[model samples]
Target: EDKVVQSPLSLVVHEGDTVTLNCSYEVTNFRSLLWYKQEKKAPTFLFMLTSSGIEKKSGRLSSILDKKELSSILNITATQTGDSAIYLCASNSGTYKYIFGTGTRLKVLA
Candidate 1:
């Protein structure tokens, strides 16, 4: 069975603080690792990593995957209160199915 694990299940930080979140997985026939941020409602797509050593960035968020280690990291720099959300990591392998991590709850205080 495929499994995704996220570190630091929760986090609390002040505005302007930087944080690093992690996701690791173990699965058969791994295809890709995806990152999403859930604020209030739906989970918004952040990044999809298929190749190692490539970093995907958007504004203050960035993520990178390490295929050799079967893990990925999400970095948020100078976080604002708006950045507070539940960060989720999922691994896709099977037919249109995904194995998701428990998620990391991040709270950024102003």
Candidate 2:
């Protein structure tokens, strides 16, 4: 069965701190790795890593994929209170369906 798992289901960090979120998965015919940030309602897409060595970054957030290791990492540098949100990782099996990991809730305090 295809599945994704994330460690440290929740985290608490102060402003200006950096955090790393880990996601490991096992899937069939893996196509891509997707990252999302969820504060309220549905999650918002952050990054999609398909090719290795090429990372996707936005502001203080960045992510990279390791196809061989079957894992992905999300890094947040100098986080702010606004960065407090749930970080989710999902794997696509070259199909319309995706396997989602148990997101990590990040709390960034001022």
Candidate 3:
């Protein structure tokens, strides 16, 4: 079965701190890796990584994928309390279906 794993399952940091979240996967006929941030009920799309050596950034959040290592990383810089959320990583292949990883829960304290 294709699998995705994320490290440091949970984190707690002060309002101005930075955090790095990690994800690694193994899939057959690989397609892409996607990142999402879940704050309440729904998860918002963060990044879609299809090519290596390319970094995708939005505001204080950034992510990159490394196909050779079958891994990806998400970095959040100067995080605010509003940044607290569960970060999810998913992989897709063949049919637009997604295999998700166990999420990383982040708590940014004021």
Top-TM-score structure, candidate number? 1
Cand. 2 Cα-lDDT: 0.93
What Cα-based lDDT does every candidate model obtain? 0.96, 0.93, 0.94
TM-score list, all predictions: 0.97, 0.96, 0.97
TM-score of 2: 0.96
In lDDT terms, which candidate is top? 1
What's the distance in Å from true for residue 65, model 2?
0.5
Q: Compared with the true structure, what per-residue lDDT tens digits does model 3 show for residues 9-78?
A: 9999998898999999999988999999998889999999999989999999999999999999999999
List the RMSD of every prediction in angstroms: 0.7, 0.8, 0.8
lDDT of 3 at 55: 97
TM-score: which is higher, 1 or 2? 1
**Clashes per model (N, Cα, C within 3 A):** 0, 0, 0
Least accurate 10 contiguous residues by lDDT in model 1: 91-100
Deviating ranges (above 4 Å) for candidate 2: none
- Order candidates by TM-score, high to low: 1, 3, 2
Q: Between 2 and 3, whose TM-score is larger? A: 3
After superposing all C-alphas onto the true structure, candidate 1 shows an RMSD in angstroms of 0.7
| Tens digits of lDDT, candidate 2, 1-110 | 88999978999999999999999999988889999999987899999999987888898999999988988999999999999999999999875879999999999999
Badly placed stretches (over 4 Å) of model 3 are: none
Better of 1 and 3 by lDDT: 1
Residue pairs whose backbone atoms clash in candidate 3: none
Model 2, position 18, has a per-residue lDDT of 95
